[model samples]
Target: MQFGIFSVSDITRDPVSGVTPTEAERIDAIVRIARKADEVGMDVFAIGEHHNPPFFSSSPTTLLANIAAQTERLILTTATTLITTNDPVRIAEEYAMLQHLSQGRMDLMIGRGNTAPVYPWFGQDIRQGLPLALENYNLLHRLWREDVVDWEGQFRTPLQGFTSVPRPLDDVPPFVWHGSIRTPEIAEQAAFYGNGFFANHIFWPTSHSLRLIDFYRQRFEHYGHGTKKQAVVGLGGQAYIAKRSQDAYKEFRPYFDEAPVYGHGPSLEDFSTMTPLSVGSPQEVIDKTLTFHDSFGDYQRQLFLMDHAGLPLKTVLEQLDLLGEEVIPVLRKELDARRDPESAPAPTHRGLTEAKYGDRPVRRPRPNANRGDNVTGASPYQDSDAEATYPSLT
Candidate 1:
């Protein structure tokens, strides 16, 4: 299993102090949080892509590339690479280049972003989001795999023998995870291609996430990918932890109450009881997170929303330290021991390649016996055989 932190890059008021961070501060903080994640042994660090106000993460690749240059082993990823609006060709080229630059430490998740206004900003209709996602992803897949592609689609012009430059390093494309909060169509799409499904389960309750995951798992098997348990699954969570449960509540309550995502909605206690968000001690977070596996089975990746809601860099870094030191190790051990081998493991470039191409036998060139010259000869098998002959019995 892979453990990591994801930031939405929300720049909200401090609630208590009524202070809002500048755009520079938020961007710098995001970098700082990513570095802290690497320093504390987190497996991955993902940044969300948003274009509207109160959110700073507009270009995930730039941020992830910066993090990639600094970190050695941390997997750099995107929480949401917009599938509906952004050009698939750009995604294919940029990420492939980033993969080479990062030495294969990058992956991305695709989604139709939550904001409706972003559609027009990118010359897309919000009503066509699903179709856009499907068509764009199909093109993106082909751009990564085929050297040259001829394609026609509803949203974009036809491509005639188009080849995306800078082909993926070693023919390995960044692994994709389809992220959806409530859309079953996205889940079906992910399963259709045997890609990872990430239920951003931070907002909704466990039952809602369970149903979405169950739908995806069933569709995954229906598409003949594998059994339900073998379906690729990733989940999202949120947490605020302290040594004592009381301190956790006292510290996180103000932020929770003022958070733009969930603020003025459910009470903290009510939200925690209903959703995957944990506001308690380290042990409480462990226990709550364990319950997810119990309900959802052994998932591939678990990412927490740790640095959102304008929490200062110092507090976020402290949270990372606690998460690294107190929570992730125990969860890793337990989840690994309980995982099934037949199930698809965490989505990685190497794992995807092995699953797709590892079993094929290597073809060796056969030498020509008739060659009198002392030169290496090509095999007869190099060309298709029209027929086989048998020697005469005479």
Candidate 2:
């Protein structure tokens, strides 16, 4: 299984110090945190996207591209690409460029996002979130696979003979994972397209997550992607670990109490018991994470939330060290011990490209130059069936 960490980019004050980091400081620290994850042998590092204050990750491509330049092997991704608000056309162009720039080390997760006001801010209605998500992703899927797209949808303006530039690296689009916290239709959507489904289990009970994952797996098999057990799945978790369980709990209680998301609600101990949040030693974290397999089957990826709730840079980095050095080694062995031979591997760009074009040369579509240095040109469309895979204007 692939293991990594995701940061929501929340800029909250340290409850212990009452000192909040400046925007510049927080952004730089995130870069450091990502570098630390890479240094510690983690497989992926995903950054969240939010347009409002207290969360400063509006431009994920710019940030992830920068992170990509600094790291070599770590996969750079977004926690959510905001499918409802951001234009699908922009999403296609930006992430396709990211795919090439990262040289096959980039992938992304798409979601409708949690912030409701963000919809209106982007000139959309919050009530139309589900439809917007469905329509937008359908368009994005077509944009990546097809060269020129002529489409009309309810959420965005129509596109006639539009093509997202810099056709994906090796002519294989970056793999996408549909992220959903409580939406089964999103799970169905992922299964329909044979994409991975990620359940954010950090905030919900195990039973709730089990139902969602089971639904995805069932739908995946129904859609003829693979067997239920072979469907690509990913889960999210949160942890704050140290050498001892008591010590970890003592250190994290203050942050948990003051956390904006769930602070001042349930006791940390209670929350840990109820959700995937484990505030304990490395062994405890390993044990808790292992239980996911029992409930969700042989999942492909496991991502933890380690650097939130105003934790200092030093502490978060140390958590990564413990996770990479102490916890992951044991978890990997134990989880792989009784592996299913037919299980699918976690999605990656190199694997996807190879699956598409093994010994043969991968096609690269070079679009005609834009007449006005933009999408418009004498013919920006590559007019190549090899990449388009079907006729345009369908």
Candidate 3:
């Protein structure tokens, strides 16, 4: 199982301090957080993209590329890459470039952003968001796999023999996770392609997310991917922790009350009871998070929203330290023990590539292949004329 932190990059005032971080501070803080993730042995660090107010991550690829340059092993990813508005061509090119820069430690989630106004800002009608997501993703998939594309779509201009540059590292595209809060269509899309389905299961009850994941898993099997359990899955969560449950509640209460997303809505107690927001001791968080795997079955990734609510940078880092030292080690062991290889397997570049193209025969060197080529540095397989005089060894 992969574990990491995801930031929406909300620039809100710290309710207790009455200080809002400058945009520069927020951006710098994200850098620090990502480095901390690497230092503490986290597997991934994802940034959410938003174009509206109170959100700093309008350009996730730029930010992730910067993070990628600094970190060595962490898998840089996006919380949401807006498939509804952004052109698929741009996403394909930009992320493929990122894949080269990162050397394959990258993946992304496709989402129709939560805000409705963002559609118009991008010159798209909100009503056509679903169709736009479907069509755009279809094009984006082809852009990665095919060397040349000649196609037309409803939302974007047609392309004739268009080839995106900086082909994906390792000849494999970055894995995609379809992130949806409530949309089953998104889940279906992920299943149809045998991609990962991520339920941002923060706001809703566990039962709701279970149903969505179940639907995706079932359809994934129906599409001939594998059994339901073998379908790729990921889940989102929120947590605040302390040595004692009381300290956690006392410290995180003010932040929760003034949270930009869910503040002034539900009591902290109500929120914890009703949603997945667990503000308590580390063990409580572990207990609740384990229940998700139990209910939804083994998943590939688990991302936590820990840096939001305007917590101080120092506090957030401390939280990460505790998570690295205490939480993740245990979760890793438990999840690994429960995972059945035939049912729930980790998604990997080699696995996905083999699944997609393994059955196809390897093309042998043609008899006249590169016959006139003068390059002396060519591989023996490409030395077709030399092969006639001397049989080549495998």
Candidate 4:
């Protein structure tokens, strides 16, 4: 299982210090956090997308691309890309650019975000959220695979012979994981495409993720991708750790009581027991995380929520140190012991490329000479990069 951290990019005030990080500080901190995750031998680093106050990650692709340049080996991805609001054409173009820039050290997770007013802010209706997500991803999937796209959808204007620039590196689009908290349609969509399903298992009961993952696995098999056990699955979790369990709670409690997401909803103890939030010693965090495999069976990725709820950058960095030095090493051993490599291997760019094209030359698309409107004429792909007739890769 791949292990790492995710950020919501929230700008919350630290309850203990009574000091909220400036937006600049929070942004810089996330960049530092991404590099630290790489330094610590973690596998993935993801940031969320939000367009409202208290959340600052409106442009996840841009931020992830920046993170991509600063680190190697870490799989840079979005905690949840807003599939409902962003133009699918832009997503296809921008992420493909990132894939090339990162040399395939990237993938993305898609979800209909929780924020409601964001729908109309982007000229979409909240009522049509599910349909928007479904249709948009369908188009995105096609955009990555097909060179010439002529599309007309309910939410977006028509496209005529459009090509999303910078065709995916190796002509293999980044692997997608559909994320959902409550909606099963998203799970169904992921399975239909033979993609991965991710449960944002933070701030919720494990049973919630269990049902969603189980349904996805069954549907994935029904669609003939693989057996139920072979379905691709990713899970989200949150934790705060220290040398002692008591210290962990004392440090996290103040932020827990006043932060926006789950504040005042349930007592911390009750919430921890009911959900995947683990505030404890390193051992406790490891022990709690292990139970997830027993509950959901073998899965592919595991991401932790480490930097949120008013935690200071220094403190969050310390948590990563504990996670890297003390927690993940043990988890890796335990999870590897239980999982067979062939049945549940890690997802990597090399692995996916080989799966798609084994011991064969990969295609490198060269765009045709410029054509106005892309409506009447354009050659979208060429085999060689040295040709003067081909436009530069976007």
Candidate 5:
């Protein structure tokens, strides 16, 4: 049960203050927010990807790398890395580099992002989003595990003896979580790969998320990774907290009413009842969050969206203080007590490295000399298995 915050990186006018932050201000604010999360002992900090306006996180890896340099223990990750639009080769290369740079203190979530027009901007078809997500991740999976890959697919050019440089830290790839709001195929994909499944549990009802999570758990066992209980699961939520429940409601109501994501629709009370959004005192937040475990069963990671809907930086920081000081300690104790002993633990880089290497020395890949870094040479790594061979174009 890891607790942390994720920002969608929206640069919008504060509904109450009527002041829209400049892009520069929003970017600076995000760094400060992540630092506050770390200071408060949160376990993970994640950011969302959006290529359009009202959102500023067009380059997640760059931002995360900066945060990783400053923070010691906080796990940095993405809420959604566009698997449909971004090339799998680039995804493999960039994230592997991030893994090494972060010292294995990171993981990532991939999804067919919600924005549709972004497809053409990236030279992809929105109608084929599902297939693109499926095919692209298939390649990314191999790119991480295999040192040299020979592959072809519908969405990209063929690869002959391609090796993404800067191989994963300790020879272990970052753990992946497939993020989806309603796609069963995505859930199925995650289960098939024995990867983590993350439900963006904010907009929809808990029952909706439960159905998808239940389906994922079922298929995860079908693939023989482990028991259904052992499936890695993560969820998204949002909260706005104050010392008193009335103060919370009073402060957050205006922002909620005008929020672009779910605004101009349901009332605050109605939306909160129908969705995972929490607005109240620390104890009230804890009470609502516990219901999530009660409905979805024991899970691994829980991330909250706190910086969106035009919340001011100072207010967001205060929210983090309350959450860290009042909400998390109690939730950690309660969830741990209620957890099934047989269920899986939260994903971490150190845990994955140890699982791969145990008592043995971890492999650090050192590329062999070649003609200007060509992959046509023999096994790239000096320590590669002797029998492994990569085909040459010559």
Candidate 6:
């Protein structure tokens, strides 16, 4: 299992300090946070996308690309890449650029985000969110895999001989994980493509997430990717830790009560009991996290929400220290011991490239001299189909 942290990128006032971090402060703090995760041996660092206030991460690729330049081993990804709203062409182009810049140290998790108003901001409709997600991803998947795409879709203008440039690093597209909270269609989509399914397991009970995961596993195997145990899965969670259990609760309670996500609703204790929110000592956190495997079975990735609800950067860094030093080490050992031998490993760039190419030379596309337009060159229909259409591989 891979363990790491993801931020929703909320810039809220600290309940204890009664001061909100400036956008500049929050942005800088996030970079520091990501660096600290890498320093502490965490495996991944992800940031969410939100186009509205109380959140700062509208452009996740730019932020992730910056972090990619700064960190060595940590895999940078998005907690939620809005597949419904963003143009699939742009996603294919931008993320492919990021893949090149990071040297394949990145992947993306796509979801129809929770915010409703984000639809019209990008000239989409919430009612069509499901189909939008499905259609857009269909196009994106083709964009990355095919050298020249001739396509038309319900949501976007038709494409004729379009190529998403900077072709995926090493001719292998970045791995994709379809993230969903309650939608089974998304799970079905992930399973159909043999892609990873990520359940945002933060808000709901373990049993609820279990149903979605189990369905995904069954469908994944039904689609003949592999056995259920071999299906790729990921779960989200939240945690806060202190030397003592009481100290953990006392420090985190105020923020929990004020948090816009779950605040002014369930008591922190009830929330923790019902969901995957763990607020306790290191041992307590480890104990709670172990139960996730018990409930969800063998999974690949585990990401926690630690920087939201106005937690100060200093405090958040302290939590990461505890997580890296005290919590994850133990969890890694225990989970490794318990994991099914037949289960899949966490997705990685090298793994995908190797899976695609094996010992053969990797393909490097070299386009013909510019023909002033893409329709006549490097397109599948070039020269009335008398010759090969794809760019010649060097």
How far is 340's C-alpha from truth in model 3 (Å)?
A: 1.9
Tens digits of lDDT, candidate 1, 1-394: 8999998888988876778999999888888889889998888999888898888888888888999999977899988899888999899988988887897798989998867889999999999999999999999999887665779999988986566756776666778899997888888899898788999988888888889899999999999989998898999999999999999999999999888878888999999999999989999999999999999998999999998776878899999999988999999988888888887777776676676568874222232344344322222222313232333459
Off by over 4 Å in 4: 371-378, 383-394
Best by TM-score: 5
Model 2: which ten-residue window has the lowest total lDDT?
A: 385-394
**Model 5, 1-394: lDDT tens per residue?**
8999988888988999899999999999999999999999999999988999988999999999999999988999999899999999998999998898899889999989867899999999999999999999999999999888899999899998788877888889899999987899999999999999999889899889999999999999999999999999999999999989999999999999999878889999999899999999999999999999999999999999998889999999999999999999999999999999999989898888888889999998887777564544447788877554555679
lDDT of each: 0.85, 0.89, 0.84, 0.88, 0.92, 0.91
Candidate 3, 304-377: lDDT as tens digits: 99899889898899999877777887888888888877775556555656765697743223222333543222
**Per-residue alpha-carbon lDDT of model 4 for 1-394, expressed as tens digits?**
8998999899999989999888898999999999999999999999999999788899888898899999978999998999999999999999999899999999999989767899999999989999999999999999998877889989899987677888899999899999997788999999999998999888788888889888999999999988888888898999989899999999899989997889988988998999999889999999999999889888889999998889998999999999998999999999989895555466777888999889898777666554664532345555433333434569
Better of 1 and 5 by lDDT: 5
User: Which candidate achieves the best lDDT against the true structure?
Assistant: 5
Clashing pairs in 1: none
Q: RMSD for all candidates, in order, please.
A: 8.1, 3.3, 6.6, 3.7, 1.6, 3.3
Supply every candidate's count of residue pairs whose N, Cα or C atoms clash at under 3 angstroms: 0, 0, 0, 1, 0, 0
lDDT tens digits, residue span 169-194, model 6:
88898889999878899999999999
**Residue 272 in candidate 5, Cα distance off native in Å:** 1.0
Which 10 consecutive residues of model 1 have the lowest summed lDDT? 375-384
Instruction: Give the CA lDDT, 0 to 100, for residue 114 in model 2.
Output: 69
Give the lDDT of residue 188 in candidate 6: 98
Look at candidate 4 and give me any clashing residue pairs.
366-382
Model 6 pairs in collision: none
Cα deviation at 248, candidate 3, in Å, is 0.5
Candidate with more favorable, higher TM-score: 2 or 6 = 6
Where model 6 places Cα greater than 4 Å from the true spot, the runs are 374-376, 379-394
lDDT: which is higher, 4 or 5?
A: 5
